[model samples]
Target chain A: MIIKRTKSHIAEIFCNVLCVFVITVVSVNAQKLNDDFFSPKSRLSFGNYLFLEKDYLRASNEYKEFLKTDNNDTVRFKLSESFLRIGRYEEAANNFKSLFFSTSLTDEARLGLFKSLFFEKNFVRFRQYRLEENYTTEKFSHDIDRLNYISYFFDSEPLPDSSRLFSAFADLNRADIKKFYYMKKNPDTKNPVTAALLSAAIPGLGKIYTGEIGDGITSLITTGLLVFLSANNFRHDHNFRGWLFAGFAALAYGGNIYGSAASAQIYNAGVKFNFDNEVKLFFEKHNYFLPEFDFVNR
Target chain B: MKKLFYKYFLLIEIFVVSSLFPQDRLSIQFDYANKLFQTSQYFDAITEYKRLLFFDEAKKYSYKAYFQIGKCYKAGAKFDEAIKYFSTASINAANENEKLSVYFEIVRTNISRRTTSRALQILDEIEKENTNTFIRDSINYWRGWTYIFADDWKNAADAFSKIKSDHELKKLCEQVEKEKVSVTFTKAISYFLPGAGEVYSGNILSGSITFGWNLLFGYLTINSFAEERIFDGMVIGSLGWLRFYRGNIQSAEESAKQKNIAIANKILKYLQYEYKGAKP
Candidate 1:
């Protein structure tokens, strides 16, 4: 009787194992069916709705889900475009690259990838990628020419044509003109350390170089007044008073030199900020100078 | 059996209800105190904080609450009450650092209220505690100012000079010492010479007035001699010159001495042992 009871327990364990295996297989298959029934197009449509609602983060997730099963080139292009629209340029670049080997849209994809890198200001890779690819599209051809001039501003390449740069400056906002000048002149001007040292030697010279005439003149005058006071106090035999004035004179002179260097840094930051904004604005107004994906069908 | 099961279920229900309710009375009182504090009703906030200490189960915030009550009283210029609450915080605070901080507050509040003696007592306790050297130095720095408020010029000079060799407080102390003059001595000197007290106290206006009065009296005495009415001139000159000369000297001394006292009082009022903001 005890042997019969042990045999039944073993049989029951085997039956339970079989049942668990069957359930696991059925659940896996059901999940696959569910995924297929939902369809990538439906997910893309929902993603587009979310995108229109201005939920970029959620829309990016939904588009990524659709792209997993939908390898159609047109859908792929839209996925890249969606990422770019939502400011997810890194993901957009990866998606755009999937079309780089396709003969039909290779030119468009390369240009789209270039734009993604440009927006992110990854200049090194953007320059390298452009060098590796050869494009036939008229649009990309024109962009390549513009890129050449822009590259000169960033890299230590020789300054682009002065007349062309000036004409571009004239068309830009009045505030941007100073930035354009900074970008144009920075590469060729005297080193900031040299300028600051020169200014320290003469209280107002660095401020003049930084285009701050008022501050330069004020620093010079203040320093001069303190020096004069110290000298006069010394001549009058007021040793303590003379030393106090002399100490103040020295402080003023040191502070002015430090301030001139700081001013130069401020000027440099302003130049970069203005130049970046102008470049971004110019491209944004021109639809990023790239192709659109209108080939995707319902 | 049914009765025992029902009793157990009833106990479980009560436990669940009590847990869910979270002793709303304590929370409501704490919230009210916080609201009062935010609204700048510092006096009302203090009352609420005291109420919470009486009724609230959580004692974690009690020390901070008491300290804040002290701060409120200090802000309102109720120095005695502020010092009392700050002392309570010092006694009841959980951590050594917290106790030290409370001790600092007590010293600060006493300084604000111009209660230098109380502040010095707290400072003494802090020093005995052997706390941070930096805190010790800061306390002594303010202790010098406390002496200045007490009008103890020599002690103030001594306290300031202790740290005078290296720190900014030394310079401030030196300036104070230079500006100080003995109140009685100023008045007494003016009695001997018109405007002498005013000049001693650095009062250009009152000193000039005294000088003019004495000069006018001297001129009248000289004119009497020039007119050749010797006997009449002698009596007139003696009466006018002596009375006016004495009065000029007395007025100069009084004004100069009053000016010095007024300056001292201004400094005391500002650094009152009861002030709430960061001390200089």
Candidate 2:
């Protein structure tokens, strides 16, 4: 009886242990599997790895995946950045536009948009911002202050008096002012078209009027030779030769007229260009007259 | 009952072996694809990566395989197809860095294709999605390169200047800006004076050649008349003088064009081969 009882006790304990093992195994099997493993951090990290390897397309996809689980602003910013890296300005602009109103990056986006416009050479729109659009001025005051001088030529409209043109001279000290006044008074004297035409009609007359004696003499000699050749050809009874001489005479006459006109135009343009440069140099030498934007002071 | 349990155990073991075998096959396929990619055999690499899908237990590597396939297509200059695979990888990748890499690759491929508008969009997305400074700086640097390729030198300069330690690229941008000749101004100069365009473009040799030709022809034309040989003068002046005079002007225009081409080549040569700055 004792042996049977001991055997029964051992059997019961073994059965209990076995049951517990089976139950544990079945419960573990019934538990949810992590088979649908999708880790955003891992994807983003691997994406960065590929990006560092210069595999941009793959990196872009990985970032996009990360976005599905994580809709963070920083990620969006990076996405737009990658687009711009590849020269997708239009799309990049769109992405940036969303951030344009955000306080943290609004200024950056605006500047970036401006840069994009500048690259496109859409000067018309660029002008519209300072003149027509009248967007908030406080955000870009420093940049505007720096760029205002260029706006004079960059814009289609007339320039404001408070900017460089007048202020540059007004702000000059005594010695600088004296130089500026002299430069203004002695404006360049260019040859007049009527003068050139009058001189051209009389061979050396155009060059003389334009104050170029050597050039006038050369023109007179050239015209006189051609005229003599036509006359001689006609006298020698060479009809074809006379006609050819006449053609040469015609060319000389036409060339003189054209050259004289061109010289006058060039002289005038040069005068204007020089005058502008003089004023610009005077101001540039004097620290541009106004004040620097004073970012440090601000 | 014991016999039945033995049979069940055997079946599980067989299942595990089969799964392991497929995994091994997938690993081999991945290795082969990577080798092809390393050798720049992009098309073949894409094929090998695609072949991994037929294996039973390759789901874990599916994301990497898709992304690699995109890279292969990108390397092959098939930007559109690369974009597709990259998009798929973005959806499939489990690692954030991997997803970012795919996005960046798409952007880069677009740049290589000169699709600037699209590339910019990708950059905007990256800026929005990323907070890492290194990645940001790198993207900005490449954006500069994209602008350079688009011939927007000022913008390229601006973009390059924004990056830290990007001095070389900044200098390159400045050089490009300095070398750029205004097309309109060049043409106008040529129209005003026969060889002036070439002279302005710093082609002194070609410009002097044109100037000399015109001067010589003009001198001969006038000298003939001064000698009083009317018939000989007329024939020589009309035929020889006129031909060379016109020829001089045409030659000036042609040389100006050649000089412009040379200037373009100078910039293109540096950009294409010798540039040490960031490039596609």
The lDDT per prediction is 0.69, 0.65
Cα distance off (Å), candidate 2, residue B55: 2.9
Q: Per-residue lDDT tens digits of candidate 2, residues A1-298? A: 9998787677667656765665565544433122111257655555555555555555566678888888655555555555655666666666656666644666555554554444344656655665644232467645544344433433334554433443433343545555544445454665567755776568666656666668778877887888888889899988788888889887877677667666667766776677667656755675433333222111
TM-score of 2: 0.40
Instruction: Name the lDDT value of residue A79 in candidate 1.
Output: 69
DockQ-based class of model 1: incorrect
- Complex DockQ, candidate 1: 0.02
lDDT of 2 by residue, B145-213 (tens): 778667677787888787854567677667767766665575576555655666776777777776676
Candidate 2 whole-model C-alpha lDDT, 0 to 1? 0.65
Pick the DockQ winner.
Answer: 2
Off by over 4 Å in 2: A1-298, B1-18, B56-58, B128-132, B188-192, B209-279
Query: What RMSD does each model have against the real structure?
Result: 20.9, 19.5
Model 1 deviation from the true structure expressed as Cα RMSD, one decimal place: 20.9
Question: Interface RMSD for each candidate model?
Answer: 22.5, 8.3
